[model samples]
Target: MLFTSIKPMLVASGDEAFDDDDYLFEPKWDGGRILLHKQGERIEAYTRDGQLVTAKFPELKEVAKSIKAYAVILDCEGIVLRGGRPVFDDFAYRGRISLSAKIKQAVLTHPAVFVAFDILLAEKECWNEPLSERKKRLSAIVDTSSSLMATMSVEGKGTILASLMKERNMEGIVAKRKNSKYIQDTVSPDWLKIKHDKTIDVMILGYREEPFSLIIGLNFRTVKNKPVGLVSDGFSQADKDLILSLSKELHTVKEVKTQWIRPELCCRIDYRDRTDTHQLRMTVFRGLLRDKRSEECVWES
Candidate 1:
């Protein structure tokens, strides 16, 4: 039997972190979510969006060989790390390289590590089992010492872990109910993600008139600065007035109908993470950063 894809359980976002004895907290890896299927000598990997990405990550084929089960479905994150920290840029770069020869070369140059967090199926369906039991079965099946490693979780320490992740510049920590059973394609409160606040100073590049949004761009030292996304929320009326005034002074006719401004003006933005296409996700304009410069609005890895 061959399995093409398995809908993975989703996590709900939380505003803050709290301690709970019935929950387990793990580091939220900043990478692509993937499901791996192995049966006999056949191996396949799919992204969260149900795209077949097996050809892109040829190195993960080694992961299938490590499993002793006749058939298994593993839930994991395809993460590329730099100096022990998960780097989304590296994962994005690898995902974009489509040529077979380049993908093979990229596997050697920038290999991705699979962080297995759950076992949806092994020998038989295990989604009905409690999370704790599923984790034990996952541990027994996966070789943690290889590129594929089991994700470690801490009980009753979500608050502390969230603080540490913030201090370490990590994305966030996910809290999972210990006794909750996996629910495919569902967004349940059983899994909650508490992301640390990430604020970046970006240049105000343009604006949309209809929705009244500000287009923001980040200056890269080597790469050309481009508009990442638009922010229309998290601003007061006074702030909007100030932006309007500033736009009038800096606006240029680079594009028709759109108000393009010089990149000298910068503002602070808060966001959860970047989308697969490198656009900002859940972004909101905090306020204008009067003290910052456009050249200083570089993205931090």
Candidate 2:
């Protein structure tokens, strides 16, 4: 079966974790979500956004040889580990390298490990099967010793695992219902992601008036400061007014309606993680850091 493009099931973000024997908890790997399609010696890999990334990570092509099935589709997270800890930035860096020589060098320098967490299809379609049955089938097909490995999951103890992840400064933990069936292209609550919120101080670079939003940027010394994203949420009227007043004094004309301000004001923002392009995700304006300087807002990770 030639699978051109298939969207994987998505997980909904959860506020807190709970213990449920009917659910399974797995480490939420901070890396790119990929779907691997294997047929005999041939293999193909696609990102969550449907980008053909098989050529990006040449080492993963060997994963096709590890699968016993004649044809199969595996859902996995592509991660690069450093000192036994998953380094998402390294994995993300691998995805961006364009040259073959550069990619090959990166492969040896920062090798990626494919953590197969779900089996969408093996020999035949298995998406309709319950997660428990699918997991069994997945475990039977893939060789655990290979670079393509199965994700370690616990029967219950979501709370415990989440706590451990936080303590270790790992990404977070995912809780999935054992009986839930894989629903393609859907953000299902059956799979919940409890990510540890990361807070960073960013300089307020610009602002918009109509809807009321502030453009934030990371402060780096070597490179030019770039916009991370906008933050309109988690701000009160007073905050907006204070920001607008400050903007009037510091604002410089950049775009027609957009006003660019001096990167003098800094505020703390709570975000999940950086996007593939290094932009902040799930960003919310926490509050102003009155004493902090814009130059003090350096990139965390």
Candidate 3:
């Protein structure tokens, strides 16, 4: 009886805002969302979509050992941070079902940690309590060494935490409204997420389609000029619609089969990565940049 994928909320800025005593805020992690299931000594963890992923992260099991409440579930963000920066390689390895020992070794190199922000259960008591109260119970979970373990995140000021995000090139910040009641079935403008602005132009050399879904061709920037990585995500609905129409206009390049564009329309993309290879690990489309000349579309080499 746990809420799995509720519509997320946002926090808005108001006059003398987030300035109440009953409010609690936490640093938004830029990692995979997790739902911890601990029902009657039946301990398991799942993704936001109810995908089982408990044994994948042994470090999380370390924290699981301390949970005293049975028949309870917790909503949290599982992060893997090293040297004060979020490391995504851990998740990448865990994702491979037939994980090799080397992959597991890499996981230890970058230990995954949980940052529980809310408790949906509290000792047979519905933790549908206020955000402030749920956070208190979650913080008391023992046997964890993660950084966000001790207290509710620094209150109400995203500017400072945003600086940390920017410093680490972290994805963005999610602001949750203070005193927002926890609801398994609700949607509101009770949370706000802000991300860093970034975009680059890439040659869409090809397009592939299944029953539904467009596969875009992405050319990587190379120092000596050789396309290395291929990126397919980061297209918006409008972009997809536009590209579907343009597919009739452009010929698919045979060698790469990447649908080529006029290179006139550039997209402003915001993304995150760990390697200097400059490949975006996760990217979301921002908008089309009409003015940036294709010559200026060049990225850092």
lDDT on C-alpha atoms for all candidate structures: 0.85, 0.86, 0.54
Top TM-score prediction, candidate number: 1
Off by over 4 Å in 2: 68-70, 82-84, 207-214, 220-223, 231-251, 254-259, 281-293
TM-score of 2: 0.81
Candidate 3 ranges with C-alpha deviation above 4 Å: 2-23, 39-42, 68-71, 100-103, 146-152, 185-187, 199-301
Candidates ranked by TM-score: 1, 2, 3
For residues 1-301, write the lDDT of model 2, one tens digit per residue.
Answer: 3567888899998988889999999999988899999888889999988899899888866787778799999999999888777877788889899899999899899898899999988888999999999999998998965478989889989999988888877889999999999998999999999988778889999988778888898865456567888887889999998888777878777786578998888899998767766688888888988789887888745
Compared to the true structure, candidate 3 yields what TM-score? 0.60
Q: What is the TM-score of each candidate against the true structure?
A: 0.85, 0.81, 0.60
RMSD of each: 3.1, 3.4, 8.9
Which candidate number would show the highest lDDT if scored against the true structure? 2
The digit string of per-residue lDDT tens for model 3 on 1-301 reads 5534333222443221233233344555656667676755466677765677766766555565667665567776777675675655444445444465654684667566767777777665544566666666776653356523432466767666667666766665656655667654344456555555444554343455532222222333433222323444666667778766755765545343345434344455544432333455455555555565445555432
Once model 3 is optimally superposed onto the true structure by TM-score, how far is the C-alpha of residue 212 displaced, in angstroms? 26
